[model samples]
Target: MNFFHGQETLSVIEWILRSVVTFFFLLFAVKVMGSRAISQLRLLDFVMALMLGNIIAHPLSDHRIGLKGSVISTIVIIILYLFGIFLNLKWTWLRNTIETMPIPLIKEGDIIYKGLKKARISIDLLLAELRKEKIADVKKVALAMWESDGKISIFLDPQYEAITPSTYQLETELFDLPRTIIKEGKIDFQALKQINKEEGWLVNELKNHHQTELNRVLLATVDYKHNLNVFLY
Candidate 1:
């Protein structure tokens, strides 16, 4: 427990214990912050992440620095972060201020130079982002926005958009996600039960259709239509 607080010296085991505790504490903190903090790093999220990392990192490197202070500071920061998120939800102005409004970088096939300056992104960076989105020509973009999360959202002109089944009024089958019945040479009995299948039936199917033994299968999936797909080891 002394290792958790400021100590003159620490054993190898104490150091290991301290690291394990810090790792789990950080995991718990991140869990409390929610998926938004991990996925979309807005202004508030960015600040929280930066502060938490700095606070936790110091104690791990120096034995004199205590884990207790870092943990307490992290908890306080998380609470403030949650409160800030709540305020953002309750007030539109605060949300707009903290998150900021999306700046239009391109509109109607024309680049807005003012938006480029406001977003503080160069034309080369914008072109690089466009390339990542598979838009080779600027003229093909109907709208391009610089999001508050530091990501650029690009919408291609309808004429240049990829043709889909709806474009031709074509009929399509209902969506059905295949359930994994077997993985890594092991049968998922729960998945089998979900599809109203038996172990014996699956083994027999593998023998008859796939012409391979059950253990030889690396992965197997069954669709809504009971179409068994198998990949061998």
Candidate 2:
């Protein structure tokens, strides 16, 4: 009891206990929030994160502050956040109000200064984002949108796009992902079974083709054509 909510003074063990309990509780809270909150921070997620951090931080630092109130407050906030997400899905007006529409940062190779002002981003930041997308020249971009998640979506002009096999009407092989048959000098029996191969065949193939022992090989993958690729340690 003292470990959770201390009296006048807390022992080191009590402090550690409080930290461990709070850590796991926060993990459970985050799990309830879902993966979207971690992957992409929207308006609701941002607010929830800030509030939860602030509420939980005080109890961890001050022994006088009990964990019970913070836990209750976190649960209530999480419920409200989930409710907000549900409302956003049900009501179009609420969704539009909370999650702002994508603003056009660039149109027809021209920079939209008004859009930049509205997005509250500087020209240098825009250029930095463009550089990240390997787009050095702004004139090469057909359209660039400022996404709600604070990411820039850039599309190159048709003329600036890279040429592919389809451009010349060339035939191409079908996509075939390689399966890992062995990793870290150990065979993955499941992957071998999926490819309709046995352990003996893999050993023989490695010996005959690569002249390498199974334990010596770091990684081995087999493609759709049964082509064995091996990497050594």
Q: What's the TM-score of every candidate structure? A: 0.97, 0.91
Report the Cα RMSD per candidate: 1.0, 1.9
Please give the lDDT score for candidate 1.
0.95
lDDT of each: 0.95, 0.92
Clashing residue pairs in candidate 1 (N, C-alpha, C atoms within 3 angstroms): none
Backbone clashes per model, in order?
A: 0, 0
RMSD of 2: 1.9
Q: Write the per-residue lDDT of candidate 2 for residues 118-146, one digit (tens) a residue.
A: 99989999999999988999999999999
Q: Which pairs of residues clash in candidate 2, taking residues 3 or more apart in a chain or in different chains?
A: none
* Top candidate (lDDT): 1
Candidate 1 C-alpha lDDT tens digits along 63-181: 99999999999999999999999999999999988887999999989999999999999999999999998889999999999999999999999999999999999999999999999
Worst 10 residues of 1 by lDDT: 1-10
Off by over 4 Å in 1: none
Q: Against the correct fold, how does model 2 do in TM-score?
A: 0.91
